[model samples]
Target: MAPAATSQKISEKDDLDATIKKLASLKPIGHSSYTGEIKSGYSGSWAEKLPETTKARYARHGVDISKGYPYVPEVDKIPKFVNEAYAIRNEVYPYVERGAKADPEKKALFGAAKEVINLTKHLGTEIVGLQLSDLNDQQKDELALLVAERVVVFFRDQDLSPQKQLELGHYWGQVEVHPQVPRISEEFNGVSVIWQDYYRAKYGLHLSFKKAIGGNAQWHTDLVHELQPAGITHLHNDAIPSVGGDTLWASGYAAYDKLSPAFQKFLDGKTAIYRSAHQYVDPENPLKGPKYVEREHPIVRTHPATGWKFLFVNRSMTVRIVGLEPEESKTILEYLFSVYEKNLDIQVRFNWRPTKEGLGTSAIWDNRASQHFAVWDHEGKENRHGTRVTSLAEIPFFDENSKSQREALGLSLD
Candidate 1:
């Protein structure tokens, strides 16, 4: 018609569509050769053969050659610190090792030692935090004791930047990125647990079919399935809604203390099964499997540094008692979970306040003595985002009573 309408050549859109169709016919990105960052640390030949430059730097920096130039503190100058930590750690080691019941005095002592040890080791600051470098020695010590005893500490008007947050976490140990996902920025490393709506569009995936975690508002510990779960998690509410998104943390130390002596004895040496069913695996992201697994850990674990014992299971990961009858396991699990759920006085709930800059704030928590839950009561309306940086430490263990005595200043568990 119109000038005999010369056969329209493939338009740019059509060309793109055709090319996309051809590409889609082939294998996806999973088939592509993308060698991302290598998994390292635990084992590697290079670790034994430290780089010449690294060795030279250590020599120049007056670092101890024997300890592989790790950040081992100056123990000679602060012998009391070591004695306190080791003493506490030793006091409860047998209880954990021998599966012996915890006496009321021992339980109280462990709780007390846990606080004192944490305070002593963390340069006398509470909650094992190093955010406020300006803290005086007394303030730091007070913070440590408070955090050790209470298990959770609160902050008001703490204006922390993401960069500062990540930097501060380094004082503890190497930061651990999410094991299976390639989502957050690499430079920030494992500092972020990023979430967003436009992410699906950016990644070119179905929106409604998959969802991000925390978006649902669930109560669980962060990455408990890992052999060494996070010692601490710094979660800042970068984005929050107008109202109704609060996070709560319960004290495991308190939970253990609240138990009757008979119950405490019954839990000694008994191990429970913890599973990894709650970790969010995006279906569209097929790099990892959605399969779940269960792990057996002590019902009561002694803090390796503090020698204090705390109840270890939370509702999210704990599946069952490893050797108990099915009915017994179910009954016990329900009871333990209820202990954490019902105890409100020993918990702290944080309300998110939308900042003027439009980013929400954050809270840092000790995963060792605390369990957390995100309140999903506010979804759809408020845009909440988070970036969490996890820290690695020794597998939580306990110490003997003699060791516990040497750790504190004549402070007994009773």
Candidate 2:
């Protein structure tokens, strides 16, 4: 006999249809509808466009570029608790001057930089500290979009209990707590993510000898095995010292563009598989990682909103080159990984400092394109704790025209 009719299933289909119909009728949202499409040979001006969520997302959170500027964070003024970078806007004058001073190609690069992020903050910007009690609907929405654009942003001076940190994680997107470890707080059922040595010792977990290989530090987007791995990650540090232990970030745009034109063409459409490296996870400690948890991503991954490309492979978790011989794969990977590692100027180093109250801080970042390395520099008797919230975004794609257009607009690989 055929399976019995399920009312629940029919109801779900109805809901799906209604949502699809609404989306089908929707037009592109935001200035991106025009600016984004312009690079694709779309000719209609802004007036011809219909309202769209993409546009709204841009409108609500986009850096106001009409005034001509670049975003520079008011690092000195913003309080420790908020993401000071949120208040960043571009300063275009110097850029324009620099462009005018340079040759034509360098001038083009300066133009492209203008389109990078919101560049105006004359009225002053606010850095809202996030806590379970303080996260209102508007702030959550703003935080989500801000994360999607900047890839990573930071928050300092938070007094987050382990439980509260997990709660904050939930607001960002799906929570992927490490399986082996118990939750950090019994009340919140929160799990803590340990980095370096001190974090492992805090919970009576001994350091695995396998870490001697220094395997975990390889670069990768977080949790690629899940249908939706987190695109944004929140790492809260609880037991930080006065100095040392800086995290480094590399911009994918610069990474991809830094490649020679011939090499760029080679990877234009190629894909590679990324997985958890067995060496990084102690084989004896199954909880830390599986022998292999695999997913495939473009070697030249693009930023969804900006349409810029990044060299996606990192030293940490990327496993093998698809369809290549073992020797060929090793050679190619070695070349690619070198490019990823060698380009340091496109990267940023974040130094950790504790607040007067002794509570440390945390940062949220997009895992899809940006690569990060946590510096294990602190050496003391004290234990340190860091919690992260990882959010998800759509998978990667490439648009060459977007890259050229971005360059024309004054965006720089630097």
Candidate 3:
């Protein structure tokens, strides 16, 4: 009697499986599989497919469109949308200003400077009426803190000599010497000259028209190939073009924020190989034994001061994710690179203009939290020359307990 009952149950299970398979194989009625065309009997109303709760919510929002093909708000009701938008603006503006002013460190330098304007929500600040030489020890300390927190700080109309710029860099850390590039002069004390034409001729650093015209430009964090890359870079442009020589900086913290949680987790445990073979070369001796410097660093590094995680890879320096297949590395790196390149919301573009006193602009940026790209748009037209001093700091490290930029700043993830 037990064997008979088991056989009946098995037959019923087989019948149920066959019925399920048959249902799965069947196509929707009045829909053509080959042409993707709906027959005459099909109404093609997607609204009807929505759940009743969704329909009710839409109705509650005054979005009833069942009576007509296209839904439009009445003329009298259009003003409500405008009023709601203004209401949202009023609600949001204070929070933005509050976030901008939340960093109390800048207030320490309030007496030394005239104005401190935050260039963007996340990065870059321009300090007016403050010269490098004018800063006292306390003001310099506060300025260092501001630069570390803001990632980049700008100064206008300042008569800062090459010697003074080097001194400013030394205030933060040891002044870095370029591995390949030469110093400006023996008198200037470790200031590297970043003259466009001179470097192009001296180092054979030729720029192609194809590269300039290409819509996608590369960005880099300075000296990522070195074992200990530069931390704070002070670039004082002595000469710039009359027009069209702008530099863009993307926030590394914002770049980290753009990644999904799963992707971020995957990246946190990995290290990437950074190489600078193509970018830098010893011009005097072309056949140097070691052509480039290579270093491996964590894919996501934490800022020591801010206690925030930031994306460290750049389009120019980062070569491959270690331990991954070539194709897999290429696919992942390309996507990660695009997070900074494609998102303009997380970037700030600075257009260069000489001061009335004929002094060029000086910008100091933190290499760990920012990547910069110099737009070579003024080729053969104007000379864009500059002197830069890189200050050495701590080696890149990742702390698992560090909060993200958004988390640290109390910003919305959305």
lDDT of 3 at 296: 83
Q: In terms of TM-score, how similar is model 3 to the real structure?
A: 0.70
Q: Give one digit per residue, the lDDT tens place, for model 1 in 230-319.
A: 565566555566687677777776677667768877886788777653222222332343224345667777764355677788776788
Q: For this target, which candidate reaches the highest TM-score against the unseen true structure?
A: 3
lDDT of 3 by residue, 227-289 (tens): 655678888876667888788888888999999989888999699998643222222332331
> Candidate 1 lDDT (Cα, whole model)?
0.49
Model 3 regions more than 4 Å off:
1-103, 213-217, 277-291
Task: Assess every candidate by TM-score.
Answer: 0.56, 0.58, 0.70
- 281-358 per-residue lDDT for model 2 (tens digits): 222332432134456767776665445566777766667778888898889888877766676665666765644455
**Where in model 1 is the C-alpha error above 4 Å?**
1-146, 156-159, 181-183, 194-216, 277-290, 354-360, 398-414
Which run of 10 residues does model 2 get worst, by summed lDDT?
A: 90-99
lDDT order of candidates, top first? 3, 1, 2
Between candidates 1 and 3, name the one with more favorable TM-score. Answer: 3
Candidate 2 stretches with Cα past 4 Å from truth are 1-133, 161-164, 185-190, 198-220, 277-291, 395-409, 412-414
Ten-residue region with minimum lDDT total, candidate 1: 91-100
Clashes of each: 27, 32, 0
